[model samples]
Target: MINTILPKPFLFLLLILICAETRAVPVPPAAVAYTADIIIYGGTSAAVTAAVRAAKDGKQVIIVSPDRHLGGLSSGGLGFTDTGNKEVIGGLSREFYHRVYMHYQQQDAWMWQKKEEYGNKGQGTPAMDGKERTMWIFEPHVAEQIMEDFIKENKITVYRKEWLNRKNGVVMKKGRILSIRTMSGKIYTGKMFIDATYEGDLMAAARVSYHIGREASAVYGEEWNGIQTGVFQHGHHFKKEVDPYKIPGNPASGLLADISAEKPGINGSGDNKLQAYCFRMCLTNHPDNRIAFPKPDGYDPLNYELLARVFQSGWNELFDKFDDIPNRKTDTNNHGPFSTDYIGMNYDYPEASYAQRKKMIKAHEDYQKGLYYFMITDPRVPANLQNRLKTWGLSKDEFKDNGNWPHQLYIREARRMVSDYVMTENEVLGKKEVPKPIGMGSYSLDSHNTQRYVTDKGFVQNEGDIGVKAPVPYSIGYGAIVPKKSECKNLLVPVCLSSSHIAYGSARMEPVFMILGESAAAAAVLAIDDQVAVQDVSYEKLEQVLLKENQKLRFGK
Candidate 1:
């Protein structure tokens, strides 16, 4: 017999190495193919609208969503519905809000608070319209219900928790995707594809060119495309002067943990930094349905010492952004200098690995939770403010799985496709005409702070927050949605369509995304019918379909 005896230590070592190697190897499961006329990737509000509209057009559609939840931010947590010119939102987008209005009409919809008790304020318009029967703002769960209704009503197939296999995920032939396999080894084959993800994961994986972070103003020939350090247009920026050093008034003591000591880039220059991200927490003052903010693990009071200093400077505008929605809850957003937007922390998230992204998300959660906890419990915060804040907590009914935190992080902007036509600030601000209008957008060019750093005088300051109003409701071009014909022929990118950073801020609104989603789906249907690449779909035909579908393409047309 062959000698098989080995030292006990050698045998144990061999077993250990084998286990490590086995764990390290990525064993992609055998793929199960699901073919359809159209394949939409993402669980965003845009994804739902795409699937819905495609089905309405008598096309077999499937949504292979990375998220278990369907409606992205609209259902995930952002229920406030950022509507600049609500009139521009038409078609299935408006239909969705109409459904929300219809749902609230039912007596049982008012579970947490009575309908009459709700406020009249919403986007500066009447929140209720018993006549029109359409509600604009709503609770998180209500929005999720609306998205689910669309899927159920249309019988659209959705694969939840199906992540795209980033590496070797997309199989293409002659600049067209043959099929895409998910992380779980499920293959999705479709005639046409729509990338509705916030991150544009599918778009990037298909070998299409995309730009992340800010582009210099020179590239887009616009004023707001790049960095703006001195311009502080929003209230969330630092208004009080506080030293950024660990020791008061001493640079030698070193900067605070999160504060970058390096100089923020020159104004109007391009940089890889992205805007800060945070959860649009659905907090409520309702006693019965409130969970007191728990002290999260790794809570550090020193991290927010600057906020305490701001409070000491007699700043008491904490509740300025506690915009009230229906029920007893508030769509609490980043307001003061040191509010929910975890500044200068998520620059790597646009291209981070999934595991790294999870860590980043968890870090943000812990930071925000700790902020709330400190606000309510710490003595440094004024007693009056403490008492005022104590009444607010995460809604007990929202986000039941993860301690009431929102399921989606506010991924404001990510990888934008370098497509045929890049929408710039000039087009968004109505200085230039959109050649082929598909959808309309009127939201201001709004971008959250990208970084918080020490100024020349060693005082803390925020950079890259802007809110420039538009001259009129501007049109979105079809070229913006379709990738460059040479890059990828069949893919339509709606969420992260071709645009400069500033213009994307206006176009990134949920309603606008849904509108673009439907338009993209309609384009896909047309492409499939005509047997053409997405770029070759005739604008005239696309217009007829969009208008017939009640897509509001322009301001007065």
Candidate 2:
């Protein structure tokens, strides 16, 4: 019919146009309904552990992760374990360390260094414990491999690099999450959901109540809740007076970079400032496994002027926090007044959009990389410390895909859920008993500096570096992980559990995250079996199941 309506040349053009138009129109793929019994949202250690526990309980589980790798900080380079009291770390968390021990028991695991060369030194404990058969410290790749093994052994499905569509991604009906959609338009439906992310992205999208930044000391009756001006429990504070101005003692010349001009808020008063964050650098001195720190784009020497002044003041403890792990590597952390922590730079990270968060993360990475470059090459830095640092380089085998840099930026604190019962200093210091104990935390009330500001005496000092030892290991309540019955019924949050800022500092350790992840999975499964909201899961039955699964609910138990 078309041939009959036009000449030969016109008809040929018409056919070509039709073909081109057809090719231009893209046929969308059929939508897949990704359904699971339990959908855990995150790629942290908690996400892996939660998936494993749910799969072990005979429920189809899935991990919708934004990360390409598993094991958040545990595999991101925090190889030097921060276990406070290893006695209380049981269940899957302890099992993870035991697996690390088993791997190291093989002679092949010792690749860079010999077994005898790597001594058994750890955080106030033996790195390789023969009694419990647990290894506390390990390389990043080892931890990642163990986590991958967990997923493979349990046959848990993980959708990696799937970013949650925070805006209108969640479908909630009658206060219960029905499904969550990722940015790639993949829909995931589940009977129960677990928010195991460090950022608490899914929990926030689901409209669960949460707190960001420090609450006042009066909010939770916690002494360490708010802005700490004069308190310096750790050695990260400024020990000597450093000039705050660009020019020595000249206020009009403008304050140096990274030092805020605002008044360090009233002591014990609340403000919306987050603690500083840094990458837990994994460094090695071995010639075979070393990649010299590259100068990041936009490197500047003046950015680290404050540290140069700190050096001139005779404060030279640069190598203090380079805590060693196996294979002659170090889990380098922020130390001294001016170290790896990008203070006053991460205030907007908790609620930032994905695009904005990417910029913030890039800024932090650049700052740290530039700092490392400065320490090694800058003439202003003390010659002795500079030479000592020149020997260390990023571990070649660790985070290889990321150019030997740690893949995860250590998010020390983020969106903490505001559930029915908030864990506070009262519970941590044993001043109050936890209700329906689910797990235990023994680490001290630790928080990194939030701001670097000038003191009233017109000298520079760091603010909010706290470290208060707990009286003893204390129980973590079930209510800390579940949302209020009215807020959300089917979801559970473990990593960003309900806790005050100071209390979360202690509970934010990787082992505790794994412990809570397992417990949250148990509760989610029981809630599904009972057909009740997570808030209504009976603590009696939950406790019995936890104990049966070898979870330590108390220190002595």
Candidate 3:
């Protein structure tokens, strides 16, 4: 009867509109509440090792990971491990490499190339050492699978893709964190917390003291803490003078892209600048498993103008860092003066909002992708170099979900905690003996170029690339992982532990992160059992458990 009063066509149209409105409305999922004895808030190698250790110790553990995939950079792209002294690596860290070794033993693991055909290349050691029973180098997918195997064997609970609400997520009472909430409205309550993220988001939100940029050399009585304008230890600086202006030798025209007009800061002085960040691309030349480098959206040639000039200067070191991995793949990294390191573009990433950081990450991806595309397509590149680059492409068998691009960017340095005893160059250089030894680091004190600015001589140059090798294996103290007693008592920060920028450079390796992660979990278990703050845990008790768990705390102990 109602349809008879109105036009049939109008009635039908109104019904359609009503149905569309109804479909547009979304129903939100209910908030989840989880309680655990220990809650780890990251998806890095440290997070997985921490969760495994906690679960092994008979403690209920939960991993609230922002990442959909496990193993941060270890599984992301850096399959070529950076093991300083393999003897110093112990506990779950060594177990990971052992697993890699076991996997490579199967003939199926050698898909692209035969096991004997792949040479044993590594960082001052064999890639697959039979005597040691460890394989330091591997593929991205293999590493992820091992991490998955770890959690599965340990029966650890993990909630992936849950980002921490940095603003009002961390709830603290009486100098201890009670619980934390994620962006998905899920609440996680724990007696002890571990901030294993490279960004240190939970640690920062909990009102813990931290440092973003380099500290002055005088601040901690160290020589390599701050800016280094002229020192070039890694040969990444421009060997030849490259003009910085749009029109060569003419200062009147604007400066070329990627060449800053600012003066290189005074050496040994402090600034808010941070080390460069880029993706560790996994590439291969096998035609069957290669996807040509994509021309990302908003491709621009000007971004790599400086690199072209470097090529023109007879600098053909672009392939210097294409370190080989299994299956004939490469773990490509920043090499030349103007390579993949997006210099000076990540200074604000340490404290940026989530949305802003994603934009920055996307910008880095675009810049790097454009660099590869430019190398292959640009006329400025040498014909021979371009031809050789054409042989290589992104590994089709790797990172298949995101078009063969790595999901995690290499965040070399970020917010580092500032606890009571900060590790400095002195501690890393073996000048001072550590008090409560928890782990060991023997890598070089390495920091990539922080900025690219014009020198007073009117040539573009890179600054902040310092590489100082440690004299011997140095011990990392327990105080470096826990926060101050007054700030937060129950939180342990392993990946972003208390260290100077120079000290962190040596200790930030993936193997070292796992060592600290396992040690931190042992301490957390002890603290929870004693019903005390993490800082109050007895070092003797922690050392006993670490040694029992096969964690190499001291050099020869």
True-structure lDDT of candidate 1 = 0.90
Deviation of model 1 at 318, angstroms:
1.1
Candidate 2 lDDT over 354-385, as tens digits, reads 99999999999999999999999989889998
The CA lDDT at 224 in model 3 is 97
Tell me the RMSD of model 1 versus the true structure: 4.1
- Alpha-carbon local distance difference test for all models: 0.90, 0.93, 0.94
Clashing pairs in 3: none
Arranged by TM-score with the best first, the candidates are 2, 3, 1
Give the poorly placed runs of model 2, Cα more than 4 Å off: 1-28
Candidate 2, overall lDDT?
0.93
Clashes of 1: 0
Tens digits of per-residue lDDT for model 1 on 351-430?
A: 88888889998999999998899899778999888899999999999988877889999999989999879999999988
The predictions' CA RMSDs to the true structure, in order, are 4.1, 3.0, 4.6
Write down the lDDT that model 3 would get: 0.94
The candidate that achieves the highest lDDT relative to the unseen native structure: 3
